[model samples]
Target: MSGHLDYEINKELGECYLFMGELDKAEQYYTKAASSNGVHADPYLGLAAIAIHRGELEGALNMYQKAHKVDPTDKTHAGIALVLMEQGRGADAFGHFVEALKVNPENMVALFSLVRLGHELNRLDEVVPHLSRYLEIDPGKSEVRYSLAGCLVCLERKDEARAELNRVLEGNPDFEPAKELLAQL
Candidate 1:
């Protein structure tokens, strides 16, 4: 119980430091947290964040993978995918991002990264459903709606794209991209 408490306190401190952009302090606390409770993934995730901030992609990937091994949470998968993407392994990262989304459909990091990768991979068709799911949860997100519309346009489903763009314009009239897309459609 004491060890669990120690882990919790250290992990929280790590998160606070990370949020404050004190990467060194955060890493120290995260390391302590990991020592206190090896089963928890948060510490490794925090460590991975620090590694990424320091531009140590290999170390970040290792930490992320360690977290995933401890607990295959959405954050761990996303973190691993992010590091892999940075290492110019987008093809490999794509599967991990998809796994992250599957674990938590609302993971915006995984969702947005997948969208960006979809374009690079020319897998717009695969990204459409993920974008649609995100929009269902966050209907007010004009950017996500715009992305969905863009995907539809690329898929040669201009009618569907027009409908999505119209919805975006309805919610945010000043959205230039939506207006331009709507006009083009």
Candidate 2:
């Protein structure tokens, strides 16, 4: 059998196990794939996901960083930031999230992290701009609209907040959070 075929089979097995919630078996197959000289970062990414699911934030970060080194894509940066955030290193998480956004502005995970962290840090002003960016990229995402509305309300922009909340209700009239926010306004 070709080395390429072995690598592919191992990586796919790893992903399958990971998605099935078998982290240890998933890691074993991922390690096999990574050791098989595969060209892609799929095995490493799978290992990182397993580490994350098992609450090994530092291990996840290291695996994600290694995957990034292998692939150097925007997703790798976002994955690293997610692990950092899980470890409660918000400032460091923010930086990696920014890097992911710089590489791919449409990276939703990175954008969402920035908005959530900004709100947590009492930087409500930052939330609007990031939310605006997300809305521009995915205008039909009602969740982003709701978040934007919440941030606007926090910043004392009642009219704008109300408008966005109305937009959210237009999509999902039964959305309790949107209804609750609207009632507040």
Candidate 3:
């Protein structure tokens, strides 16, 4: 069989084992897949996931870096950002999340993380645009709309915040948080 075919088979096996919670089996197949092909990032991503599951943060970071080097995709950037967040490197994680969003604007994980990190770091200005984009993609998410309203309130954009709160209340009339926020506004 061709090396690429072998790599695909090994990678599939690794994923199956990982899904079944067989870490050792998954690791073995993932390692085999990594050696089977020198170009694809899936094996490294799989290994990174295993490392994360095992609490080997440094190993997971290294594996994610390797995956990113191979394929600089949004998934790799998001993985690195998540690991950085776990390490308490919020600033660094924020940057990676931004990169992930730039690479794929529809990346909800990156968007949500960026919004959360932005709020925690008091960078509401940076978060507003992303939150708006998220709402565009998922208008039914009342909680996100509520969060956007809270961020707007912090920015003193009362009119915009009130609009968002109204939207949330319209979607879910019993959403007390939105009702409270609207009343405050």
In angstroms, give how far residue 46 of model 1 lies from its true place: 0.8
Give Cα distance to truth, residue 130, candidate 1, Å. Answer: 0.7
Candidate 2 lDDT for residue 134: 68
Tens digit per residue, CA lDDT, model 1, 1-185: 68889999999999999999999999999999998844888899889989988999999999999989989988988998998899899999999999999889889899999999999999989898888888778899999999999999988998999999989988999999889888888
Q: Model 3, range 65-115, lDDT digits (tens) per residue?
A: 999999999999999999999999999999899899878877879888888
Off by over 4 Å in 1: none
Give every collision pair in model 2: none
Ranking by TM-score: 1, 3, 2
Write out the backbone clash pairs for model 3: none
| TM-score, one value per model | 0.92, 0.85, 0.91
CA displacement after TM-score superposition, residue 80 of candidate 3 (Å): 0.5
Error of 1 at 129 (Å): 0.9
The stretch of ten residues in a row with the least summed lDDT in candidate 3 is: 127-136
